[model samples]
Target: MVLMQAEKTAIGSICFLAGPFTLLENALVLGVIAATATLRRRPTYLFIASIALADVFASCFFTTSFLDFHLFRQSDGPTAYLFKLGGVTMAFTSSVGSLLLTALDRYLCIHQASSYKVLLTRRRALLCLLILWSVTIFISFLPLMGWRCPTGLIPPCSRLFPYVNHGYLACWTSFTLVLLTLILCAYALILLKAHRHETSMTSLQGAAGTGHARMRMDIRLARTFGLILLILVGCWLPALSFMLADVFVILTHTQQRAFAFCSTLCLVNSAVNPLLYALRCRELRVALLQLLQRLCVIGRCKKTTQDLPPGIHFTEEISCTAITEHEIPTNGTMQLHSVSEMVNN
Candidate 1:
């Protein structure tokens, strides 16, 4: 029992440290997207912005409630506890829903390259976001609205066990599983289509000129989608499995510890997302660097543009020129310019 308590203490410390980092990471992504007009107009970055925003909320609420429940052990009444859990649930759910939207956007980009713009306009994307938040808010707050355990329940009533309804967990888990399945299927089709495109290009243009460019673009996109798919499964599957199990059977002490660890693993996803989804994109990266530079200037830092790092200075110049001249190539898609094309190689 002492050992178990020590382990929990270590995990709680780690969670406390990770919370602020995740919040800053997502907040930077959101700031970059909001400050960059070029990114805001595109559907992909808009979805990314939604994900970042959700993560910002997730990090804040999850860290607060999780620390309170595990470490502080303070007794905020059942109403306050339920509200915190609902906020955390709603934030994470919105993050997942935004991820699904991003996957669909990528699929449409590859599948309907020509008419993708018409299919998913900025207005439609905003509407979809609005609808997603509305549905998730309603679903997440059901516990607060009378789906919780009865008031007469014993001391364990504060934790998720007797506090939140089991039926709600089951339903939410099922819904999340369905979303994951759809995301997986979407990425699968995207990879298949990219493969066919590659094969066709190789057969038709063997050892040829512009075909190599197209091939490289397709390959890069495939790699990005593959990485996203891998991370999503790695981060979410274990937690969902544990949640499903908890819905049916009571967890032993060890099992509860494992579940808590798995839940923390889910929060790690939010921290890594800016690296995978936002910073990996050349345009967004350039914009983020520029945003940082502007912040440095406002802070009265003595660093000059020449003092910037090698590749960043060059890339920032190129990005600024491209934005100013409106010469960023899209290759008939609505997405931002690829890194290769952005560098004008």
Candidate 2:
């Protein structure tokens, strides 16, 4: 029993520490996107703003679960119910759903261009956002309303009763599998279309420098898109696979770890998008640098204002000090001069 408790404690601690990195990464992404927009003269990222909010809500579960188990010395005190109901269920689930929406948005933007704007307009995105949040909240609230039981347990705090394991994993698994299959098929078709266009260009131009250059550009773009697809698959597959396995075979302790790891990986994946964008897209990188500098300047100004002495009379003596240091003298003495004060040392 003691050993088991210790193991849980250790795992929980690791989880809490690792989870915050997701927040930091997301925050950086938000900064980068906003900075890029201002520097490049584009609009700010309303999408990133939503994502940042969701990630923060998700942390209520990610951070608290770990701290309750590993950080707090108290074995029991204000946990389980509050954290699971308010934190884990609401925050984490909404975050995951937001990710699904994000993936679908990107997929549509790349593959189904003709209807993209019409279907994925501001109104549509907002509607989708509302629906996703509503669903998550409703699902999480089912237990409290006595419609369904909870799912799991934290030591001496909250416990989740397995309600419908078959539907639990099967539903999400089937939904994801179907959606991903369609997404991949669409991407494949899009690639084929791009290739055909390139071929016609090549035929017309006889593979000149411009045609060759376009071909290379096409290949690089395809590679970048492919990377994003692979990341989505690699991060989510483990958890989905475990959910499937749980339906047929027993989910051993090892499998539990794998599922949990997958969940964590997906969370980290949300934070990774901006980094990948910056690395694969040059424009993104430049924008990111600008945002960082802007934020730094803003931060510096705020700090300076906060630190300013009281009543310096806004326009005191305005003297500019230009300090110059002469090269060390032959005798190993240093020379310093201030232009404004005309002082020598």
Candidate 3:
């Protein structure tokens, strides 16, 4: 019993430390995205920023769970119920909902390429985010009405009751399963469209070059989303599976620890997203680099021009190439001949 208590304490301590770290890392990512005018203007980045915000909330909520239970030594009363029902559930749901929104955003980009801008306007995106928050808040509070511990099971915070446990489990599992399915289907359609575009581009002419450029862009975006999906599943599925099992079969002491470990893994997902952006998105990478430079972390006196967003560099490159190709005379003799003829005339 003593050993078991010690193990639980160690785990709580680890989670407590991890919570602040996760919040800091995600906050920095948000700061970089918000500080960069280029990133803030892009519609897709709005969804990314929303995810970061959710992550920040998640870190705060999860951290509070550990602190309330361990360091504060709070009994399983109102505070415990608040953290369990309010903090963890709400945070997890919000993060999952944000990912669904992101997948939907990507789908709209691929589905309505001609008028994606019109379809996914800034107004609509913000509205979607607001809806997610409203819906999650509604669901998270449902248990407060009656789905909580029964009067008899009160005090000591009985999380093991069939009614309360299954109530939470059913809601989460259904939401998770539905979102997981939709995301999978969305990515499937995205992949199919990209493949078709690739095949059609092979037969075209000047447009083929641009088509290929679009294809590369699509592939890169798809890869990043795919990684997000994989990470989400890898982290949450095992823990969710265990939760579902707990509904039918009682978990042993060892199984309880496994559940805790898996739950911690799910929280870790919130932190990884910023790292993914830094790794996969060139614009984000450059923005982060510029941010670090300004902070004197890189020890560089001059800012690097190569760290500009791709669109800016693309325009500059095209303008420079146009000038070089049309404005400058390639042959010195021809230039001299034309000038001399004009002078003689």
How many steric overlaps are in each model, in order?
A: 0, 7, 0
Preferred candidate (lDDT higher): 1 or 2 = 1
RMSD of each: 11.3, 8.3, 11.8
User: How much is the lDDT of residue 329 in candidate 3?
Assistant: 62
Q: What is the C-alpha lDDT of each candidate?
A: 0.80, 0.56, 0.69
For 1-345, candidate 1 gives per-residue lDDT tens digits of 112677768878778788899999889899889999989999899999999999999899988888777777666776887899899999999999999999899899989999999999999999999999999999999988988877523332322344766677788999999998999999999888987887787778776765768768777877887888888889999889887887766666677777778888778888888888788889998998899877865555334335644553243433332242244454213223443454465
Over 180-285, each residue of candidate 3 has an lDDT whose tens digit, in order, gives 7787888788888877776666556556477767678778867866887789789888887877776666666677667666777766888787776444678888
Clashing residue pairs, backbone N/CA/C < 3 A, model 2: 35-291, 80-158, 150-160, 150-161, 151-160, 151-161, 152-160
Rank order (by lDDT, best first) = 1, 3, 2
The worst-scoring run of ten residues by lDDT in candidate 2 lies at: 315-324
Q: How many backbone clashes can be found in candidate 3?
A: 0
Give the Cα error of residue 61 in candidate 3, in Å. Answer: 1.5
Which ten residues in a row are the worst by lDDT in model 3? 312-321
Who wins the TM-score comparison? 1
Pitting candidate 2 against candidate 3, the one with the higher TM-score is 3
